[model samples]
Target: MATLKEFEDALREHGMNMALALLERLRERDRATRTVKPARRLTGQKMTPELARAILDLHATTGMTQQEIAFKVGVNQGRVNEVIKRGKWLTDDPQAPEAVARDKAKARLRGEPKPKKAAVKEKKVAPRRTNQGQLALGDL
Candidate 1:
């Protein structure tokens, strides 16, 4: 089946200017009728006790899925799952696992270098040899 774009291309190929103009007018009318929605959060926000509570409340009170709850709360879906299922980030304690992880992430974001692990020495590999137009055509 030909798509609208394909049909438009065909019309253009056949020099149907009137039909193309009509499509443009229709597109303009459709755009005019479309309702504008407020921009959604693109970046995930730092998860707090309040945010976790909001996620839990949404999970318990509404039929919203983890992704929907995450979107509404402006956090990761996995964070939402943790709050709903495992009950992480429900406290303001800095020693909590989620809080520690969030602190580490913030540190990394602030350009602080993480503690380095013990370096493992890798075995050196010899480069492979290749004949570049040096072998005769009959050489196998």
Candidate 2:
């Protein structure tokens, strides 16, 4: 393993191309060991199939604007556009165990089924309720 100072010295002497490749490999290794977050809560709101249907139904029946949906739902108009235009993330990557665990927690809260592996995990990492009777994820 080359010290960063040594690598920088090499970069200064030999030029960036080779040293940069080695630096990138080091960064990749660092990233591999790091506990990366699975999902980013974007400016876009999360819309379940139910929420998607609700938005569509409202628009189809009432001819509401993006601003109207945003106001009614209490999200940004951009979020409404993302939901109505781009889409939501439902079928997420299965390899993400953390995401799977979160989904299991959410499903249990919603009185829904979990997969076999998720059901097994439910007994272990399931959240506790507060004195206020909150499930801890809070309202969307």
Candidate 3:
């Protein structure tokens, strides 16, 4: 019969061998299933200047949402948004009322001064008295 120490050593060796075999089998399976394919470039829909103008015009005149314009123009809403952001629709000489409002909002966010509003005059109220004819704690 093997000694207690010999038995423990044999068991440990067997467990290690089993673990290594399992890892090797997993590696082989992974290698068999894995395919090495060439990375493809991501191509998105390209918008021309005319298309951008049309999108802006539809949004401005028809009150159409970005999603609606994207659907009509065969592009994504994000692409439409990008075109609108970079286009001259907002920054050009023919600034739309919405563009002017957007510019004002941007300027306000940048700490630019806007037209001051008329301040309302506050009315002062008399202090409250308790039923005992003493001043209330809140008044104090």
* Weakest lDDT window of 10 consecutive positions for candidate 2: 38-47
Candidate 2: deviation at residue 134, Å?
A: 76
Task: Per model, state how many residue pairs clash.
Answer: 0, 0, 0
Candidate 3, residues 1-140, lDDT tens digits: the string is 99756755776787877756666688799999999885332343455557778888888899788988887777788868976786644334436654577678888999999978899899898787656575788987
lDDT of all the models against the reference? 0.88, 0.67, 0.72
Instruction: Give the per-residue lDDT digits (tens) of candidate 2, residues 1-140.
Output: 99878867888787778768878899899998999675433355554556656666676688789889776765667756756775543335554554566577889999987556534443466576556654556663
Cα lDDT tens digits for candidate 1, 24-130: 99999999999977668767788788888888888999999999888887887898988888999899998998778878998999999997998999989987777
Highest lDDT: which candidate?
A: 1
Which candidate comes out best when scored by TM-score?
1
Q: Sum up the clashes in candidate 1.
A: 0
Off by over 4 Å in 2: 1-46, 89-140
Worst 10 residues of 1 by lDDT: 128-137
lDDT for position 135 in model 1: 70
**C-alpha lDDT (0 to 100) for residue 129 of candidate 3:** 64
